[model samples]
Target: MDPNAQPDRLSDLPDVLLVLIMSFLSFKERAQTNFLSKRWESLYLETRDLSFKESDFLTASVYANPIRWLKARADFVGYVRRLVDRIRDQPIETFGISISYPKPYLELIESLMAFAVQKRVKSLVLDFSNLVWRTYNDVNIEKLVVKIPQSVYDLTSLESLEVCACKDFDPSKLSKLGKLRSVSFGWMELTDLPPLLETSRLESLTMKECLVHDLEKISSVHLREVAIYNCDFYFMCIFNLPRVDIFKYRGDIMSFGFDQMNTIISEVELDFGAAEKKNDVSYDSYGIEAGMICEFLNNLLDEGRRTATTLTVCPFLLKVIPRSEHPHFLRPMKTKHLVLKTKLHPKEFNGIRLLLLTCPYLETLTIDLLPPSPIATASSYAGIDPQTYWMQNMSYWCLWEALTTVIVKNFVGGATELNIVKCMLRSVGERLERVELHMPFDLDESRKTFALAKSEMLQRSSMNVKVVVHNS
Candidate 1:
């Protein structure tokens, strides 16, 4: 084998490896590879998965001269058609297309989908958002959807489908595909999706900046995880979940219809803010506006049956949850690993404690304390606790059992911080164990916060907790 010597044949690499490489490439690149040699002429067609992107075509179609674009359009269309014909009748496991309709690319996309459907391609992903995000105010998939071949439903292997940012898409045929497993959507109204998507086998679903109207009915037969963000959802709806592990949603006054879940899902993620709506959903008409943010939290505290193991509260999302008064458990997590990260002085510490009080099985806590954005004198702070800034609540609560391990990050030695630690230690009583405090502070503040913690903590013993000091 010599570096200067050419290989005897390109086919020596094996067809399986070529198909794998082709799957990672876009349609245009795959087309270009066909010109490399006779052996590669059909290599692109052999690939069971394909992703044709309109942006790639348009980006390359541009030239310094407009005259060249007009002259080249016909040749480009002819070349693409030939490529599609090459793959016709081939066994396709997945056939997907993404279009950024900057100008007018729908015709090309429609022809492509027709070819894929004729071959009974299984999975499909139509992403029309790249153009919408750049030019339009919103994304809906209606104007771009076409009359797809009904035979698409006949593909039993069809499992995952993602339709994002189209004009308006009617998901009517999803129910016919019994083998479908996962569905992802964005910037589309919630149609009768349950009727369309045979979601009985759905494992994971994700929606972003979308809308859910009447939540319909979701039974936890095989659902594993659900994530919805920046969505307008139905209010006062009872969700019966059985065997769901993760449920994530964001909107104001989100009611947990968790009374009917058959088995507990492992993780639950949410945003503590009202979902702004341009359309009516059951959740919005119930007066769960931004002002009544705590009402959303109150509902979670009362409705959630399964406690979460991993809890993440977005501080920005939480600020919208009216902290003028302490809120108890916007649904607490029995998740052993609790991660608290905040930029606003965590005014929700007590609220978190109240929420977790119901979690009978929590083990570890990790706290990340972010410094306040700017200085606020005593007057600007007003009603906030002057010493610990632990909201205005004068209440006694233990965040979790004393046996729980506590890790505090960004621990600065300040009078306020020291008081907060002292107060927390007092609550632990005889249960406190190892506390890892990453305290970086001035000599006096560091010593005082440490001393207060030592004196106030009557938990297991002073030796159980140790403070790691870093000079600021």
Candidate 2:
């Protein structure tokens, strides 16, 4: 060997380290290591993590020619079966299969699952959701009703299971997987999902873009975290989770209620996105009935007053406050940290004013201005004016007494944001310490201009307050 040549440190590593490194690669990539050397030929077999995605085998040309596609699918199945057979008695930690059309390959998939069960796999991920995008023109949709194999529910050794786009996966068929601690379901009908929450030992659950029809209640004692994003609900749902610590929800406002009112929660985030406009089409925003929105928020805040110390919400929550009917409608909040995802509109200011009156102990405040939405109808802007509303001398006890830190996100050096910042500074009671302005990525301003903006804010403060500007 040349003296200048590098040593083969990678090959010198122990077999356990090499197998562990190969475990992170896909099955095909791991198998390709067989060509490297005789010692590497069988090293891939000892890897306990197996991931086989059908897209790795099929190509664009195969898709264009049906015969080639069929042959490729057959070859992929045969190769996987042979590999699984070779490692039948080995202990597997995780097994994942991502196939496009599971309808025609149900038996093979089931056999693969059986192998995982026998090997005591700790995590299993079955992603048949790709079938939705791949079969738009190739296969009939009505005949593609794929369900999870019944063997999955019986896998007591499974600690985590994630199923995506299996359309007919009935939650009622879920048996008690005693060791299962985490589960995620995507793109399916979860009308019966409440049963799993009640029956399982799951500590974490996530659902995305699924249809929830008449999900009445979730009563869970073991569940600790839950995230529901972009899922459509038919009616109001009730939550009875006593031990849940972290909860997050996004999408259209859905009416909901909680059974345990006094239980303290760790954190909660509710984000109802701003409306959008595409071409000439107008997507309606914040369309829930006023009474329903009011009731929903009241219930949530009532719980938040006792349970949550940190809360994050969208401008829509502020826009719908029942100010006229009851001045003290909102219960006094104990929330110390508050995050407001807003648009800085006049109505949003009115709502913020109402909210500030209730949070007498707020320590930190964040105002994140969402990207501008399409112009709504004139009627939507009928009542409030941003300039006069924020400039008023009303007392915000939280800003005066307890507020120490403030963060403004998506700052554009606009008049609305500046005035809001001025208003907050004027109301500073003593505890207010630092204010940070996080500029947008596409801000059309120079460093000197940003420094001048920060200087202007500092000039508006009544006491010694630090103003920091971050231009992204």
Candidate 3:
């Protein structure tokens, strides 16, 4: 030992403090601390959060060779069993295990889940999807799935649960989970979700790529956030919820009962994939599908119904809304903030104008210009002119008094962007306070175009407005 050696201040910390810091690190990262000093070799064993993934033990070369893959699987199984045995008596707050292949390790996984229940774990995550199998399309979906064991229902202390790539999961035993507050499921088939909602005091729920059949209605007094993405649904409805704050849905158009959401939601997102032209229904024809969509949007702000403070929508809704002169076709929106994710095409200009007139109290607006998808080129009404469309007789109370800020994302200095900006400036230039343009990459031409437009805008309108540009 050298007399002039610097003192090991970091390693000299107390064991309680060191264990508190190690609790935030992953299992693999905490293992590296064993090499720091002899004292740290056994300090990480006291951590209360244990998360393990099988991929952490295998290399790329081992995945490419069949013989090496078999040996690596055996080694991973042994490692997990030995590690869990060492910490069997330690109380854990979280227990997460991700296995790529679980067919041959059913008993082992059952023992691990039983261990979690005995340790009074608060959060659990069970993931069984294979990475290589999914990326290379080597195995069927059913071959990689596993069913939840009965021992999972004994986790009365669980507050959060996440299960992925599971099938035929009988949710009848979920009544025992009275302490659950949040739940998420993916790539699964479920029926009658009311049992879980009715039994537990759930606050947040999310589901994706699932097949739900014969669901009557979703009603939870304690729920605050709900998201359902790309799922096949049968007989699903949104019933009485008084405490919900945010709602998000993304999928094909379907009949959803929308007259019962009786709360003031903070935000709502409706993203229908690419905009596709329905051959059966024209823009003037109020067909069954088109009528259903219009009715749903109308109910968002109707009397004794739900209303959102912020609304986000895709281009499909703009293209499918019926262009009727009847007042009942579209209702006045109560949203204060509106976000539109679109390609800024000419055909959508009329819809944008209609929305501006409807939202009487809107204060801020955002237009996120998305890249054109492959199917967007097949739009039927692509020949409309923006200049003629925007130059019409209109009465917008928001533009005169309420609206102040406007933001444009992914700006590329296109003709459509210039025309829209000019139209906005003409309508509310005196009252507008700030305008922001966010560009994708560095482009000097875009900055120059904005500079010229800013100069002309100030010359024509009031000098109270501020224009700014940002590059990403």
Q: Write the per-residue lDDT of candidate 3 for residues 376-407, one digit (tens) a residue.
A: 33233556765455555443443547778888
What pairs collide in candidate 2?
A: 264-307, 400-429
Model 1, span 175-289: residue lDDT tens = 6677777878776666666655344467777776666666655544666777776666654556555666777876444544445453344565655533434335542243334
Identify the runs in model 3 with alpha carbons over 4 angstroms from their true place. Answer: 1-91, 130-145, 236-238, 274-289, 303-305, 322-328, 372-381, 385-400, 412-415, 438-463, 468-472
How far residue 167's Cα lies from its native spot in candidate 1, in Å, is: 5.8
Count clashing pairs, candidate 3.
0
Q: lDDT per residue, candidate 2, 1-472, as tens digits?
A: 7999999999999999999899877767887898999889788778889888887767777877889989988898888888888887778999988887777888887788778778778999887766435212333435545566677777778899888777577765554778889988776666677677888888888887677776877678888888887776778778777788888887665667877643666787876652221123322233333344455656765634555667787876676563434332556677778888887777676668766776778888888878782112112354566555567776645344778888888776666677677777778755678888877776555844864565465656555677887767
Better of 2 and 3 by TM-score: 3
lDDT of 2 at 294: 52
lDDT of each: 0.57, 0.72, 0.71
Any runs in candidate 2 off by more than 4 Å, and if so which?
1-92, 98-115, 130-144, 191-195, 230-236, 273-288, 301-305, 322-328, 373-389, 398-400, 439-463, 468-472
Worst 10 residues of 1 by lDDT: 373-382
- lDDT (Cα) of model 2: 0.72
Deviation (Å) of 330 in candidate 1 = 4.6
Global Cα RMSD, each model? 9.2, 6.4, 5.9
TM-score per prediction, in order, is 0.62, 0.71, 0.75
